[model samples]
Target: MSRDNPTSLEQRLSVHLQPLYPDEDPARMAQACLEAMELSPSATPVKPHANLWSERDTVVITYGDSIRREAEAPLQTLRQFCHDHLSDCISTLHILPFFPYSSDDGFSVMDYTTVNPALGNWDDIETLSAEFKIMGDLVINHCSSRSLWFDNFRQSIDPGASFFYCAPGDADTSMVVRPRTSPLLREVETPDGVKHVWCTFSHDQVDLNFENPDVLYEFIKIIRLYLEKGIRWFRMDAVAFVWKKLGTACINLPETHELIRLLRLLIEHKAPDAVIITETNIPNHENLTYFGNANEAHLIYNFSLPPLLLNTLITGNCTHLKSWLMTMPPAQFGTTYLNFVASHDGIGLRPTEGLLSEWEVDTMISTLQRFGAKVSCRTNAQGEPKPYEINISLWNALQGTAQHGPDTWQYARFMCAHAIMASLEGIPAFYIHSLIATENDYERIENTGHFRSINRHIWDADALSDALQDTGTHHHKVINGMRRLLEIRCKQPAFHPNATQFTLHLGESLFAFWRQSTDRRQSIFAIHNISDQPQSLNLSELNLVSTDQWTDLISEQHFEDRVAQLELAPYQYMWLTNL
Candidate 1:
């Protein structure tokens, strides 16, 4: 351990490994772990030089197979589109789980070392990385049962027998937080005998046993493989349930935080600019624990924002949202939140557990369901079904009294929602579907029998190009609107992740906030009318300044004198800054 900093990796690894291997030599274990961090002598990796956690950084989350062409690989078409269309607005591309998978839309990864052959090869990934920084998912919680590791485990090989968790039948294991209503112990036949292994997500996705140091070392190698391929940001998927203990909720455990910190240190040591963002979709208080003294995740997903934002729009109120934001703990200097409205998965409701009332949540779920959204449920400890997530495109989620199909009012509403998201005090991520302004693909859901497929639409390259060229189309309106917003957002230093946020409690039908730059030289006042009806903003009470020289950046309009009172059209927003 270093004499200057006792909390360094050497000291922390010793403490973290003691409980897992009580009798083993901690010094030897730490040495082995450090040895694994070194790259193979024959390998030649690219030099990484991407800076993360910047105000100009806006992430676009998509799948490698999202956009396709007739003969070209999907990833190739995606890269072409990024170069030809989105190169200016998007700074980072978050390709979701591009590895080979068996089910769950790449969540059940069969091979972590290779890309899905159907969606281009490593050449395509490297090409995209050359243009824009890439973020990849480290789905380390579980692996596909069809993977070679699982097969070898079934054969009871020396190294494979201890790769996954196969618990004893007599062991006491009752208290566990189940994300899905699935069986905890899955029965499988090994060469030795029948075994019941821990399957946290699904029977097809078996959880690995971290109790074995071999698994940890193997994951370290997998991460290095990604680093060699040019992944600057790593998203840890479903990591809350990574470490488990009997007679407990099996989430946010002490071991889990230590493991995250350990990974953070190793990655920072390897690539000084590399960033790790944890995707823990739990409650607010529990999720913040991942930023353990700035030694864990550089960013944690703002899971509460989606549902709470929905509640604000649906109920025509921002009271709860304001209260939640006021209570949100500020991030450390280098760590911030990954704010997003929609992603590959559904809009999570668990993050809004205490922020919203039961009736309020019921109303949100019911309203979205009326607008053609699907709801997924999880079983509580009392064996009752509870709403877990609302699966729908964000465009449809914000649709209210605008008629279902393509309409200007619907587009305006979507833009308003995005404006509020962009003004938030963190890096804003837009889902690929949301960026293109596409609606629910009911045909996809009917054909695949997967509800999440509604938002996960497989787009054609030529059709997307045609739609973008046509100004009247849905894709053009939403994509261009977002591009303009990002253009202005990137130029504003007040939108930095470390900016200070002050909630302005105007009323129920409006959500307003002021974001000031860290140096306090620049500020932006963002106001949004969440309701369908027009509302008036009282400027007399705001006391912004002595003069009325303010400019609306979104509309590019200047206000000189009549700033006493202003009216906001239905679902309208403005980003006002002193000129």
Candidate 2:
């Protein structure tokens, strides 16, 4: 083609995207942007993606009230503790969302840009952000509804501020919202007439209107603000409902994906290393969307693991656990799963809600129904169970915490979970209290009248003197066990995630799998007995030529001779390192 009718590379690429992002300046959009990465042709497809997390790389996470005041601040001490023990192995740290929210924990925010003075001043946050940044990884996600952007959307009386999406033009309608399913009904007074806004889970969390270009820009500014402070990861909080359309469940909309991709494109051009993590609390099926092209979230939470981990504890069995493990897909092979036993919010009854039989969910819902909890999604109309709040309390109370004794039935349940979470297939997270086996803050719930009690207790690393499995003080064992696992994992590069996992089922109680590297230098195999009774197994099935002298990383013990048979103690665990 002649120069006048040229189909040059620059023109071709420019014309390709000009129509879609018309608002983005074409000249600026042509500026260097990060290319989407796919597996290299030379790379093996079966290998697991390497870990962004390393035992020696340092991990920093923030939690509790960033707004907590008049309380002896533990953030400084926590930082010191992380530095003291981790030194180099763990590097990046993430703080929980402390943006101003409309109760229901801090999940729903009222203003995004403003720091909730209760946690600390913006100066304090900036100071801390600097401290963490210079030392290593510091990250915070753009907040929920509490953001100024959302506030503008929720801002009625001002038609000029179209930053947020309102429910039709009905800000004033009369409707009573029973916060809980109990008889205590609360009026949600709206403008004009008191009409109730669809809270979905709670009454206050009004969805934002991302359709407005202003809201998108505001979030971009929010992202830039945190990045300016040296935050490396931004946890995209509650992203499932970001963009909604009519006649749909108003979730995971096409616009939502477009919005996320656009944000990703922006981040790629500006902050290449900055990572986005999605905090969707749905099952694995729904949660997978967050990892959009591996470009969306650098990591996604392993939410499904918790309840199943709990179920394994109660039944002392691994069948269900094995099945779930099989369902895990390699959206992007080798990417890390942010595994956790507990988090800032309450434990959700997700993932498994789809897997479990209706009868099982019904039974649990009925139990909660008897307690005045109203169940939704996974529950029937016969029971008005408060699935949201009660699930949180019940999960925390029943775990192998110091709250209940060995005879309390919940004792073994807690212990069983301990073994599973520490050995699971992802980056395991330790809830502040869960680390020390802190008991459930039942009184906090009773006092707060909401889930904020989940965040009430202070974290004292040295306060616990109880045994790891000692009733409620189960934290010591769990921490050390996790530390030891990570330590062993770091010793071998093969554990770095370029490996494949092959699972083996030896009866219902014994669950075993190996994270095997191609070179076989760091093939790590773990066997767990989530059973009330001891399990004995044959070695022929596992391809182990020599079973003598296999080291138990957590207990620091060595077991000799499983050439013929291997025995697992009740609620036992084993991690074998390959030569």
Candidate 3:
């Protein structure tokens, strides 16, 4: 069926809605959905551009208050900082959840429609959106227990009375999957009776009942409002556990995927340039399902990259990393991966289910612990505590190798990881802290009593500006190095998000890959020495064209002979390209 046809759209909506709402008339519900989106049945479908993203597109994820100044809203300060430093390299800004919230660092949303007054207002977001494509979180899975919706539920009022999911106290929920070890059901007193409301992440975050169509309608309106405010990229945060069934694992259910498709359909119809990104921190195979024949998420987070990359750099071996990369299928057009080494949260271990062995994971965890990283755990099906993620900044995580312990190659190793990420066939996102090479903030962890707080350090804007200007600090060096790489990457066609990528069989000590532009006009051999010892590679190994000149994009060095030997220092990487 043609997606642009009005009749086909209605049919598609009905097909997606039937499984989700078996009792309702799908046609009626579909019409109501169109009404909610303020779209007519015959409205022309706005076709998305052929190239939604490109090599020039890079993202930086940061909290609104990550860099703060006195007597000014944090969003304003963030805007000024990005304009001054990131405007040249970064094309998008992912301001993590700026909505009014009760807890969980803006995840537990209190009012989805209003911006957090502490940060700024919609005007500030609109202004920032004008300068850069803005990515906002659609915290669709749950809401704050202190929200008006939840409060109204307690009073048994309209809208909220049927908005929350509740089950009996003795209901069996042993098969449910969640990232938190918190109790699945939270006891609440309502006018009708005592309710055991579902809490996927924490007791303070009450899960919304998507079984009720009203909830879906509410989110559609929220998406519309965000588009009006110029937020083109929507990050569905913690979306895996949105739907639940009694006797099955709650995460990644088919109904959840259907909901995503419905949202994607509606969003694209409204704003052709809008992008829907799913934040599912699950196993590799299951995470791939979010692409859904190119009908679901426009971008899925490369969840396995962080832990695997950390292991590769720390152990000086790319056997596992190479194997995993070789197995990954390139993303289809209209969809790609969002690759990153760090974010506001920790390095999720769940995505490493089959990629890394138990011993390898334990060893990596222990090594991170030695570098002052904290481990967060979740309850498994057998009710055993297991490591969920490692909470530490990227700079601290790469302080040294597991064999040699902390060393002087921290700076080089850190840059090597990012360089490899940049050269991969995907859009690279940098966390604000990682760009500045911030260390673990144990002080924030102690203050908040949360392990993730270690990586969520808030910087004073003036102090950070001074550090960047000093040039002697690692902050200055890391940011400058990142900018240079991104600037160079943006000009290369081989680095396009959907470019062809093939893993190179260099060695365990060196990780390498070949990327060719879509039009076959440019080729790049991205190689990195992950070991602490110097490594050598014969230029002939790459089979470079004898007639065509080749150059290292990073150092601008010319390779005169195909058989010439190239020496790479420890933690060094090269982008050998033929333009």
The order of the candidates by TM-score, greatest first, is 3, 1, 2
Q: How accurate is candidate 3 locally (lDDT)?
A: 0.93
* Prediction 2 global C-alpha lDDT: 0.52
RMSD list, candidates in order? 3.3, 7.3, 1.5
For model 1 the local lDDT of residue 483 reads 89
lDDT, candidate 2, residue 453?
Answer: 65
Clash count of each predicted structure: 0, 64, 0
Estimate, for each residue in 1-579, the C-alpha lDDT of model 1 and write its tens digit.
543345545555666666667777866777677778783322332233233567788999999978889999999999998888789877899999998999989999999999999998888899899998899999988999998889989998855677888777666656677778777788889888989888888899999988788999889988888988999899999999888888788888888887887777678777777889999999998998888887788889999999988887766778998899889887878788899999988999899889998988888888888878998877788766788889999888877732232334677778887888888987899998898988888999998787888899988888988998898888898888888999999888888888888888888888998988878867788899987779998776454765547788988887665445788998899888874
Model 3, 1-579: lDDT tens digits are 443453656777887888899999988999888888877666556554345899999999999999999999999999999999999999999999999998999999999999999999999999999999999999999999999999999999977998999989999999999988888999999889999999999999999999999999998999999999999999999999999899999889999999999989888888889999999999999999999988899999999999999999999999999999999999989999999999999999999999999999999999999999999999999988999999999999999999989999999999999998999988999999999999999999989999999999999999999999898999999999999999999999999999999999998999999999999889999999998999999987896877678999999998888898889999999999987
**Local distance difference test scores for all models:** 0.83, 0.52, 0.93
TM-score of 3: 0.98
Residues 1-579, model 2: lDDT tens digits: 232352433332234234435576533433322122221212222212334454233233446342222354444544555555444344455666555566655656666565555555455555555545321111122234444543433444442145434464334322322223432112333343432334444445554455554445456666666666566666776676665544455556665665565565455445555555676777678788777666456677888776666555545666877898888874365356777756556556655667766665454444434433333332223434435423343334443322122334343445446445545555555554554445556466677765546444654444433344354454655556445555655565434433566777677888778776546555556777776667897666665547334565656665455555777776667776545
- Candidates 2 and 3: which is better by lDDT? 3
Candidate 3 deviant stretches above 4 angstroms: 1-6, 46-49
Report the backbone clash tally of model 2: 64
Candidate with maximal TM-score: 3
Rank the models by lDDT, top first. Answer: 3, 1, 2
Candidate 2: where are CA atoms >4 Å away?
A: 1-51, 54-62, 66-74, 84-90, 121-160, 169-203, 362-416, 451-456, 459-482, 492-494, 545-550, 555-562
C-alpha lDDT (0 to 100) for residue 4 of candidate 1: 36
